[model samples]
Target: MTTFDGLPPLRDVIQTHGLVAKKSLGQNFLLDLNLTSKIARLAGDLTKCDVLEVGPGPGGLTRGLLAEGARKVLAVEKDSRAMGPLSEISDVYPGRLEVINADALDINPLEQLTAPVRIVSNLPYNVGTELLIRWLTPPTWPPYWASLTLMFQREVANRIVAKPGNKTYGRLAILSQWRTTPRLVLELPPEAFSPPPKVHSAVVHFEALEKPRFEADAKVLERIVAAGFNQRRKMLRASLKGVKPEIEDDLRAAGIKPTDRAEQVSLEGWCALAREIAKT
Candidate 1:
């Protein structure tokens, strides 16, 4: 039994099930139960929350979430080989764990998750950024999850909680901060994983706000932000010129200078610009 959850130790489980982290699937299994539990704790109280976890490779974090008293966990695992190890976890946790063998991007987690959902995952590197974008850009406010606790490559993690004028600041920071309060909670070295990815990893915890921090049309905001950051080195006048015919006027109205670069604009300023551009 493992000390963290009283299930088998992860290394034993891995050897028993022949669970090798598949590079093709972007798998670098985090085998430390203690660390996984710590990551789960970062999600706050999970006793009543349904956790939606993606890429539960070998079920390390799955066990942690269950042990941490998550009301229920909907674990989406694309690798079928992991089902054996995951099944053993489900048996231990009983009804609290549900395993879905499918691509997380292909399925809608809301269909399986109950309200007050907390999305917690040691996300696969290949799909982490894409998944975060999808979660942040959902059609309506508050989307489906109450909070998001996800691990990403350190570089990507920095982008999530970055602020204006930072080199990492851009679309991710703006989009993340516009709707949720994101904080970088923990950092892990490469040695923390089974395969040990070359780069370090970090966990980001995001608490969803009832409403966007600032009001703006989602589509308009997305469009202009994309344009500005797509050519981040260029001044807004040059980069966002294609977004709206009267780009300079809109920038001024938003209290931003047309000469400002994308990274120079604050979230509030970007939202203001989105609103200004939407008026046209």
Candidate 2:
């Protein structure tokens, strides 16, 4: 009845706790220990790092993180039903796992986790992108976590690592690549989850850079990127005309063609444009 980690198999835990995946909260539990453990391993050398796990339904990935030697795990679960099962995990791990029965979106996990942290989660689909943006654009540079190993829908994963000229490229791509090295590490079929989601999912690993890849004002860069992609089909000169009094001039000054569309511009090009626009 027990798995290699000495914890009961996730199904047994779910059954014992009467856990049911709630679609409204974006819960889709990964029942396979080996798969979850593999995901934990992808985070790399967790022995010294405190890990943050969101929505630890039935503690599948939670157990993975502990078994793989994470120094400690702060698991934030929104569903009250999960607290009981997760507490059981906390009992087994003995001070290694801390479960917070609150929405991951509301609280600052850094308050509970220690230094040299890494965030590893099979993020609930609903708030995954929003949480990623919050992490990507924290108030200061070199935010708490040194790395992020997260799971998202395949479409989103592609967008995170998408390159200029790819249809998937947009604000998300710019933000992800601007200050971090993001790569698609693994892919999963829908059947992997307890109540399979409608789409395939993938894991992405992001290592934070000491500084942004290029020098540009963060606020200005975000404004430019958002405006540029808001009307991605229009030429930069037209799409960004409202951004400033003379955006075409700024675009040319940045070495960007006035006729180029948003998807045609690289991250460096966007930085250049942001820098140029900031001058006016």
Q: Write the per-residue lDDT of candidate 2 for residues 1-280, one digit (tens) a residue.
A: 7688787888888888899899999988899899999999999999999999988888889899999999999999899998888888888899899888999889988779898999999999999999999999988998889999999999999999999999999999999999999999999999999899999999999999999999999999999999999999999898898898689889888999999999999999999999988876
Q: Which residue pairs in candidate 1 collide?
A: none
RMSD of each: 1.0, 0.8
True-vs-predicted CA distance for residue 81, candidate 2, Å:
0.2
TM-score computed on alpha carbons, candidate 2: 0.98
Candidate 1: segments with Cα more than 4 A from true spot: none
**C-alpha TM-scores of all predictions:** 0.98, 0.98
**How many clashing pairs per prediction, in order?**
0, 0
Candidate 2 ranges with C-alpha deviation above 4 Å: none
Residue-level lDDT of model 1, residues 11-65, one tens digit each, is: 8888998888889999999999989999999999999999999999899899999
The ten-residue window of minimal lDDT in model 2 covers 1-10
